[model samples]
Target: MVAGPKVVHQSMPVLDVQYRCVAKGIEETVDISAAAAAVAVVTPPSSPSFRPASELDLRESDAISDVALDVNVLPFVPSIRSGSYSDIGPRRYMEDEHICIDDLSTHMGSLFKCPTPSAFYGVFDGHGGPDAAAYLRRHVMRFFFEDTDFPQSLQVDDVFLEDVENSVRKAYLLADHALADECTVNKSSGTTVLTTLVFGRLLLVANAGDCRAVLCRKGEAVDMSQDHRPIYAAERQRVVESGGFIDDGYLNGVLSVSRALGDWDLKLPRGSPSPLIAEPEFRQALLTEEDEFLIIGCDGIWDVMSSQHAVSIVRKGLRRHDDPQQCARELVMEALRLNTFDNLTVIVICFSNEQQDSSPSQQQPPVLRCCSLSAEALCNLRRWLDDDRSN
Candidate 1:
């Protein structure tokens, strides 16, 4: 079994007393005290309930032999194709940003050695302002691949997974630090991040906020990451232990999420333990034929719909059109119809070469035809009409 990444707490210096905030290209000096007092009131969404995989019934024929399940055998591999859509739903400005790279190795070229058939995707949901999210989006590749020591291994083994996890954790922390160092981003602004990395059949997800990743496995919704909110028991305990309190489901009575990148005002005095940390929780899965696609979205979508509900919609869309981009658009429109109160962003990543239309096709109704009368019948009808007219 591969061990998870070990977290180390490091203190960071608090920002200066006055914070300069940049929103929509306007710069305004914000007092830290005032910023802390003004908290956005957002209704927390219900936590997702997922059934354990063991509880799912599997047919004997679907089971793989031990020999085929071996890592060296490579029984199944995913052909990834992705598309995304975003809308500033009900919000004055869009604060969500995302990235979808279908081919990572080819994109990176000779910058660093990467496994074949690699891809990367991420969603950043910002609060307080859009600066944090925008900054991360601009520098995400550098932070993950260039700044941090990302592991270079051709093999997908337990050791490689451990190394990748460590590297990704470091990258998250590095981004957090970079946000603080950036003079343009506001100290109070922060963004929740969820990222997915795919190397051949291995899928790894690292999340630090409410943004979620859901996998469609044989038409069932499998949650790939957990939402880190103050209402969650584990997160609540951690916040309290770090000298923070949750007020009305808000962490520290200010932020909605328990973990995020940036938000220097909440995390600083440069490394005493802070309630709002940049550490990301990791989840991994070995993909198989049953795994069809993945849905990564901001809280806007999840707030209005369940994971299974989103999966069903996307599955139906794929069956009808097999267009991931259209599926993403449908998701956003559905969220709007459901009246989500925040910005919306969604990414649909398909694993199969083509849409799998498993449902039986409906037969078209038979056509009805009109028949013409014969010449003798027409003459008889004409004579009857003439006799009626004469009478």
Candidate 2:
């Protein structure tokens, strides 16, 4: 007789057999397969959780994605009824400014199978020049993606939020330095940076200068980005402290806008309360099914159209089965219709394809949606630097 514990149980799946074995072995070795035939318990089946129905395009995506813009000529601007401006002004006679887009993603979580497609669509309305917007086009989106914690879990509290905010601030400052190094001809180059990024379910929107981002949630208009206008209370105070007086009719004695890039002429004094800064105001929002499309455009659009009016037209256009490109095109067309007389650009981003019934309400009157800044317009901004470049 052998002295040892009994082999109490065995479980088998496919080729493998597992058992609760206690060694009670004598010198005689028996076939182990028979030992596996002990008590085998069958576990009850359970259903797997179902995933949502919305489908994602699975084809491999490029780091920089390009979609052609629908170029339309506005023969008569007044015919477009969606916005306040009636004339887009003179037709341009120059080389077409190239508009390109690039995105980088982070895979920081289990659900992060692919790089979070941080999509960016900006409408830079270049006035003094395209350098500002062009600078942004080259660096802003990439800057945000670089060194960022991808798919960062929201469970992190204030500490994480602070880190994120600091990251963005550093990115902006880096862009400023990078611009100084890259472009010599356009030292005064500046552009309004209005960027919207979608990573998983989080939406981060950042802006500097007059460009704006408006979010349409549940058929209601929401301001996602704050316009850094000269008249904003904080901006006004900053201006006063900088010895820059807001002229009776303007943001300040010199510049019409309170906040901007490439206006190195407006930096604050050594001991000024609010330092001369071009840092972007940042906002983070959790995106849900209710969040519709996002509209980000230069001041040209926001100048002529109110946030609510822009939302209405975009919502209606979407209801008409307008794609993101179409909605963006229509928004630009509307701004031109209002006679904005400035560089016009619009980027409309549809978050999801799910549709819903319109809320019962009277259509509000058309407001304004003018915008400005362009990557190609930087050529003109170089001249401004020669005129102003204070240390």
- In model 1, the worst 10-residue window by lDDT is 1-10
The residue ranges of model 2 lying beyond 4 angstroms of the native Cα positions read 1-118, 121-123, 147-161, 180-185, 248-252, 268-276, 354-391
Which lDDT tens digits does candidate 1 get at residues 276-313?
99999999999988888999999999999999999999
Task: Give TM per candidate.
Answer: 0.73, 0.58
What is the Cα-based TM-score of model 1?
0.73
Evaluate model 2: give its TM-score: 0.58
**Per-residue lDDT for 82-193 in model 2, tens only?**
1111123344621112232323233223443332444434444443456655666655556654644432443434565566577667766666556555644265455556
Q: Which structure among the candidates has the greatest TM-score?
A: 1
Best by lDDT: 1
User: What's model 2's overall lDDT?
Assistant: 0.52
